[model samples]
Target chain A: MAPVKNGRYLFNEIPSGYPIPGQTTVYDESETIDLDTVPLNGGALVKLLVVSIDPYLRGRMRRAEAKSYNEPFKIGEPLMNWGVGLVLRSDSSSVKAGDHVYGYFKFQQYEIVDATRVLVLENKEGLPWSAYVGVAGMPGQTAYHAWKEFAEAKKGDTVFVTTGAGVVGATVVQLAKADGLKVIASAGSDDKVEFMKSIGVDVPFNYKTTKTAEVLEKEGPINVYWDNVGGESFEAAIEYAAKGARFIECGMISGYNTSEVYQVKNLMKIVTKQLHIHGFIVTDLMPKYNPEFYSSFVGRIGRGEIAYKEHLLVGLERAGEGILDVQSGRNFGKCVIVVGEDKA
Target chain B: MAPVKNGRYLFNEIPSGYPIPGQTTVYDESETIDLDTVPLNGGALVKLLVVSIDPYLRGRMRRAEAKSYNEPFKIGEPLMNWGVGLVLRSDSSSVKAGDHVYGYFKFQQYEIVDATRVLVLENKEGLPWSAYVGVAGMPGQTAYHAWKEFAEAKKGDTVFVTTGAGVVGATVVQLAKADGLKVIASAGSDDKVEFMKSIGVDVPFNYKTTKTAEVLEKEGPINVYWDNVGGESFEAAIEYAAKGARFIECGMISGYNTSEVYQVKNLMKIVTKQLHIHGFIVTDLMPKYNPEFYSSFVGRIGRGEIAYKEHLLVGLERAGEGILDVQSGRNFGKCVIVVGEDKA
Candidate 1:
């Protein structure tokens, strides 16, 4: 084949608040990668199949270095995140040509990466290739780590998950149910609430319409709070937390895009209720938990014991649109860009 | 003994913010308790010698039933807290008629309590009777439990204690120093800064004059924080916390008397820095750690290795003023009302 045309998204300017389309420049043919030009350093040339768009990417887009757990995305560089691809050419014995793999890579159509840096997807188990970017991937591992390590979830425990219809929250809801815990979930819209209900959420409420504190007062005394959306939801969780409750601080999507952070007034409840509020990044826990996650979590997904949803936007040029959809809560579930066909 | 005419302070009305003079009622010679009157239960009749005034009393003054770890003081009843006393008569064998003891009791000139409810002070070590209510008592126990159980303070670790010159903060500063930890303390006034310095604080700053965040950035990336005064101070601690720091939440005196709690905006630092912020009531840990506290901690105080200060008001009628002094940060150390002389 004559060199395949490569398309990529570039970080143009750091956003002040919510990122706009102009902040990221999309080039349909940013470069051309020749198959004959494979690296001699035991690397693989891969065609990107799917790119996972996550909320944490917003924190990396700051003008100044935000004191964060992860490094900020450099301006004038290709935005990088978790993605899965098919190896078109390989010089390494670890991964051969046509092997499916996933790892951190740029949001581009095609690229060459060191074979040791990417994990070969050994057992897709006849599942959709996109599953490697969603339930059977990072988000799935995050839910697993949080529940097992931080939540201390037990049978008959009551858990409240914010953004319940989203990828991580939905997975957590199903996991809690499977473990015999009652799950209460909150979402922004009616459809999302219904989606959570369909997925075995014991109680689902539209947070925009019904007050979380009011609903919690009626239905709660929450034992575990899986906080995906912060600000008001955090305050509500504090108000309804059982004594010695576990507050798993997964993400703060509510404050990610806003210039003004939500002023949490009732943090004293942490003391009064003797609650434990712990925040963690999934990548930080992966090295220790990845083996169990890949073995146990992957088998569950393969057997359909766990389910997932995805909103796939085709082509690398639409990556920015996918991020915007996720940011606006317009996307139904795990948002991903389908860069090329999975020929597995 | 002319019946030893008794005076008492009663909880009148709950205050909206800070307790005013009228919120607590001072009754001089309210009733004459005849020494002849003895309880049906085998109890001791004690002449209250000193009443310990504490910041936590503000929480008990809230009109609404705050979901607190402790019970609220009832209106129309004598305000109760840790107090030191001289036994006038004994119906039980725990103590004799002339023994000096201390425990939780009413803020009154004299009262009858079950003998099992009080602990006799065995070794005065030439320390003042007031020491039982200050250094050798509840506040001391609080600091001990916090450091031993939650702080996990290590040698060379930098600890920042808010209200550094006050009872609990001063005790914490001394304890940390004894443990070979470097100490940074903040107080509201210049004299308090000097007081903190006298107690061996490595760095002392008047929070009113110098910004806690700026001073901390200059002097430290605090490894452990003992939070006595929350709000701006807690926010400042979050801004300068070292990675894997421990924040010991002792009290929020800054917000105790205010209608509006300070909005802590930098709490996300807890996640980024992987900090552990745990709030504990000293009493909760007493059952588990009190033996160590009394045995090891009391010996330290007796040997002059641990020091303390008392801001004493001369009469039971001055209890309201004592509380107000603590509220306004006017009291230099452990505020207490000296109700009567210790005649042991």
Candidate 2:
């Protein structure tokens, strides 16, 4: 077999604030991978299909010594994230050639990865390949488990979700609305706001134009708050939180790439309002709720009963730009980089 | 029968910061209550025994228009609080003359209060009357329920408690210690630190002399934080919290009086560390947990198995000074004003 041209985004430098796509993530397209003869060593050789570029990846662009829930992207190596891949060759019984798999993988077009890192997944849903790494995958499971465990919103309860057009936030907004709760959600752009409204968000606004506190003061005293982009909006949520409100802290995308983190001045309201603020890493809940989530959401998402919008960057070469777009709030929907063609 | 001399503390002025002992609270000792002839319309004429002065009262010193969990102390009226009283005369079936009752009452030597405002309690455990308003009362219940519901801690878990010498904090320290958790507690003074140590606190520090962050960084990465004084210490707690740490926000006494509320810069840790920060009003839990708390703690407290320290101010004339001491963080233990003697 011919040596296939491989493109990869290498972690070249640790970033201070927002990662500079070209310098921080050096896209090297000159490399080649001989998939037919590469060493498997009880592992699998995977051709990357669709890769999810999420805001959480920004947290990994730090010094190796700094501690966080996710490991820092190592310098001189490929940046890593959850992505869908087609297993081309395998020495492990867990995966075979031509099987679709999803898990943590390198930000490269082709790679030899340990079997443990990838889980063989059957895309019976006929949804887009990106859905395997996104809405029906990790982010979907995150939204599902977090809302189930913490949101605790009852019928007629008012919920406010930030980043409502993004994958995780939009899922929670829909779930909240499905439970007969009034959903107030925010997005960065007018288009995203419209998308939020299209998805049954009772009150949708572009946070870039309107102040979050003003909107919340008028329409909320939110019973439940799904926090995705935490900063000024987080402060507002705390300010307008109803007594016994629950704040599900899923992500803080706003603070991830910035040096000047917004100071929350109204935490005293947490005490006065008797609020419950819960933060959780989805992976922690995966062992307990992943199966439940797959059973609950996969079929719904596939049949078009639950909608998942994808902002696709059609090549691995665009992975760096896609991540930057996500961190800067420029990308709408679930941002996914298509590394290779998916076989129908 | 002769009219009895009555001394009371009136809410004379709304305070901007800390309430002034004399100006904000006007001590009126000229009024007299005719004990024999005063009408009790379906209520009780009670002689106040011991009254609790808490930092929460500072929140009520605001303008009447300002909303809070508690009502404002109306101008020219007596300041009200939880107190133990003797029912000198009763026109209600709930209480008879000579029975000891506990409830919300004015900071006066004598008053006629509605029956619904008080509950008759027989001190079968023979604890001090001050205990009825202090350790064995609302403060104790606050500590008990807040800890049981939110602490969610296990043995060997490192716990940090602020205001460790106060009634609620000390009780929590003891409870955490009883559960075999490592307790690191802070107090305002060296004397109070000694009291914390005496109450089985593993590490006791005088926050006045030592920086909270420095101590926490050295001794912590605390698993549970019982936040009574929320300001600099609360920020320190967030910074040093272990993964999935639980913060029981029982009170934010540090912010109750000041206009300059502490701006927390590290709430992003709430997401990264997967923290659970819970705020609750103990009163909300009372109907369900109050009886359980008394049955569980009263016998232990009475037998001296569970220690309670009281900071006593021995007269109705000292009520203003007592409340000032409490709000300023100057008073130690349970700040209780002994209004009248308890008949043994």
Candidate 3:
């Protein structure tokens, strides 16, 4: 065949705190990869379909010297993250050309990757292809695992979820509610608060207008705290936590982009209340829980028991903007960059 | 029996931050309690020997409206705490007049208390009467229970103890070392650091001079963090914690007296590192661990396998100063106020 020009978003500079537009540069013709070029030992030429934009990607924009779970993105290299793609060509028996796949891959329109790294998506079951990058994706799995393993969520237990309208938080809210938990969710705007309420959240408050402590005192003595937005919200949860409460530290989006850290004063209450604060990454649970995730979690989504929302940005060029939108709480749900239409 | 004139320290005023001298008043001949005015049923008249001055007492000095596990001290009433005492008079079957006992009692020269509230000391074993208030008492039990139940301490594990030379911290240091764990301890003074070193702490740093993060980085990838002096030290521990590390939040003595809370900036690492931070009050474990604590922990103390230090101030009049000293890290080891000679 012929050579194709690949459009990719490159990490141009290390951000001081938040990533600005200049830090991520879009190159429409960053590289040319010949379709004839196949792996010497069996790899795949994948065309990117949907790319996920998450809060954690912000940490990758920092200097390489900054220690984190994920390595910093190398300047002048294409950003790499979890995304769904179509196998344009394959040299291995694991996957064939035109097979839908999902795994860790570069944030580019087209690329050649090792076939073994990507998993072939077998069953779509009338769901949108973007669902694999949202509800049945990393973020959804994170919410499920955190709730199952870390939350210790019980029926009739009152749970407070921060960033309640966002992807992971929204999933957690629905899961908790479905499991008979009394859900109180916090969002940044009136619209987001309404969205949380519409999803059967017992009490949804706009955190921008209401003091978290006031809402907690009025509606809480929270049994489980599903933390997505940390800092002041975390402090408030500590103050309002019930005796023997479990605090699931899922994400701290509030402090990820800013240098100014919120000093949590009520941590002492954690002792007085006998609180257990646990931090976790979803990927760590994949080996054990992925099977259950695929069977039970996917079944729940298929049966309409699980509900999900997505904020899609078309084109690879808007990948940086999608990340910034998620970081700034401008996106309503699971933020994704729709690089190409699903041709399957 | 003659009427006894008691010298008592009364809680005069609620403190905004640290308790000032005037907040606590030493009233000599405060009240005349006639031995004849015994309980309508049965009671004991006890003369205080050594009163334990602890950091938790700071919480008691707050306004009555402030909710806490322990009740606030009533203004103009004698300050009450854990003290070892000689029973001057008893009308109950549990003990005689000459018997020594230890439990929660008024911080005065003499107190008329119910017989059921105190436990008679059966085995002194050549240990100091003050040892009942220190090493073999509440503080020692606290250290033991915190380590056994909370720390999840294992051999070869690198454990970091804050306030390393203080009562609870010193005990934790010795216990961790005895368990075959590598111990990194932080103290406030050069003398305290030396004390920590003498007690087999693998690395002891004065947190006042050297940055706790600096010392932790130099000596750690700490597995178990036994936090006593919280605030900055706790923040530092969060920074250097290893993945799946356990942070036993025993106390935050550093923030107790001060209104200014330290903003813990590195708490986000708890998620990245998959840390479990649990807060617990030692009293909560008393029912479960107290028997084992009394048997094994006390046996260890008696055998000299356990070492303890005390910064004892003479007389109940100096109770306020003793508290201030402990709060400021001016006094080393367990801060105890020796109210009267033990005539056992």
Candidate 4:
């Protein structure tokens, strides 16, 4: 390969207020090139190919405590992030270079990771490497584990999921369909509605156009609400929740700019209907943060049991805007920054 | 002995706004009393001694599918409610005349419950009978279960509890104390503050005087928020919640009739902190709606291992106003309408 030069996009500056245009910074390969010598002390180098952009990253950019899942990115240093990668070099030899893997890493062209944090891929199978950064990664794990642990989803129950075509939400819709439930999802556009339908969401509504309450009144008293967007979506979920409903709070994309502070009319529902609304981080609920739960999911994608779609931005330079697009609900499916081809 | 009456406080007219004089139509005692027969079914017939006057009862008077814990009280009925009582007769022998019990009952002077719902007062040593309506009753169970199961408190953690001297809140403050944590509480009056302190709340702030945010900032970053009031109290809890905190949604007395809505800000605390805020009904979380838990608690109280207290208002004439006073945060302890006094 072209004598591996440098890294790419990372949390450059802690963002304040809304992300202004051109907030993300990237390094030219020539300027930040690593020395020809690898770390002999004990390190492995990986060439990151695909990095996932999720709505939660915006919260990480902010200077706040009480974060949901992963800790916030440090203010100045290159923002550490999550991605699918290919191992380019290794020192302690559990395996040689050129094996595929994925895990949390900095947004970079090439970087070193402690051997333990680097999960080596055994089989790419027929599934593209991108699936690791989307469906077969945290997205699928979060969806499956959340439903299994927090929510009680029986067959024939009406399911409501906001940001339905998102990484985790999309997986949840499919998982619910597999279990024989009626799925009603909310997305941002008409095209997304069609996209959701292809993947098993029976009724997908464009929340921007149709009011969630009016639709729920005609069709609902929904039994389960997998909330991806928090503000208006949470209000809708609380309004339509059936008696003994289960509200699984996944993320809050809609109210990222505003940690909503106001009164809720449905306060009585929590007691009257005896609703069980829970806010959880998937990793925390797991008995052990095991890859086994994800293995079957990966196998599904590898065997073509599920579809893994992605919004791939061409260069690491484009990731900043890609993150903005994903955060603002402009991009559909799993947003990924394709930093480089796995050409070792 | 006074003959039992079945007259009701009816919602003959829906209030256009906040409650005023004449909104409740109390049918005269002469209208519904059944004085002809002393005979009753076996294992039933309770002489109600204490009735709960929680603020959420106000919602039952309305005519909407507003979120609620108990179904709205039917308009023409005396209004089904929660109470502690003494059995007048019991042919089934599970309970005999003069035994104390607690469960769902009516607002009338006497009630005949089947064997299915009555919880017998088996252990009454250090604990008083009033605890059956207060700390050792439904309110106590609600506080204990919510704070334990949902909030997951541990030693040295900081907790914030609203409506601190109310029946449930007072118990929650002590239960949290028993677990070895610092508690910051909000109450309406200075006397209530002293009551909270007596019950183990470390810092009691009179909510009527001090701003909630100011109190939280001075003594916060709370690990658990036991909210006994939903309106602005719920909003402030979210703001003060610590990273990875658990917010326990207990009740909302603050917004009894103002706009029928509760608002909350600082919602981003959910994701950013990975918060596990749960809106729950204690009965559901406890298996069999509280058999072992309640009985074990009673055992504790009898052994002087637990100390529970309450506020009792004498006579049925003031029951309506007692309920209103409880809703207004005027009661210093558990709000119970006393229907009789033991002649002992």
TM-score of chain B of each: 0.95, 0.96, 0.96, 0.87
lDDT of 2 by residue, B217-322 (tens): 9999899999988888888998999999999998888888777867777777899899999999888999988888778688888888888887899988788898
Fraction of the native A-B contacts that model 3 recovers: 0.89
* Each prediction's TM-score versus the true structure: 0.94, 0.98, 0.94, 0.87
- Each prediction's DockQ against the real complex: 0.52, 0.81, 0.74, 0.43
By lDDT rank, best first, the candidates go 2, 3, 1, 4
Residue-by-residue lDDT tens digits, candidate 1, A202-241: 8999998999999899888899999888888899998898
Show pairs that collide, candidate 2: none
lDDT of 1 by residue, B1-344 (tens): 34657787888888877787655554446677777664526888898999899988988886555667778888888889998899988888998799888889898877888888788887647667777788788888888887888888889999999888887889999989988998999998998888888889999989888889998988889999998878888898988988778888888788777769788887666666767777777777888887887777888888988767789999888888888889989898799889988873
lDDT of 2 at B5: 84
Model 2: residues with Cα > 4 Å off, grouped in runs? none
Which has the greatest lDDT?
2
Question: What lDDT is obtained when candidate 2 is compared to the true structure?
Answer: 0.88
Runs of candidate 3 exceeding 4 Å displacement? A21-23, B88-99, B124-126
Candidate with the greatest DockQ versus the true structure: 2
Cα lDDT, model 4, residue B81: 62
Candidate 2, residues A1-344, lDDT tens digits: the string is: 88878988899998888888888888887889787898899999888898888888888888889888778889988988899999888999889989999988898988888988678887778877889888998889889999999988799999999999999988998889789999999998999998998999999999889999999999987999999888888889988888999999988888887788687778877888999999999899998898877776888898887776888999777888898898898888889999898651
What is candidate 4's lDDT per residue for B143-227, written digit by digit as tens? 7777767767789999998888777777778788888989999888998888777777888989989998888988988998887
Enumerate residue pairs that collide in model 3: none
Superposition TM-score, candidate 2 onto the true structure: 0.98
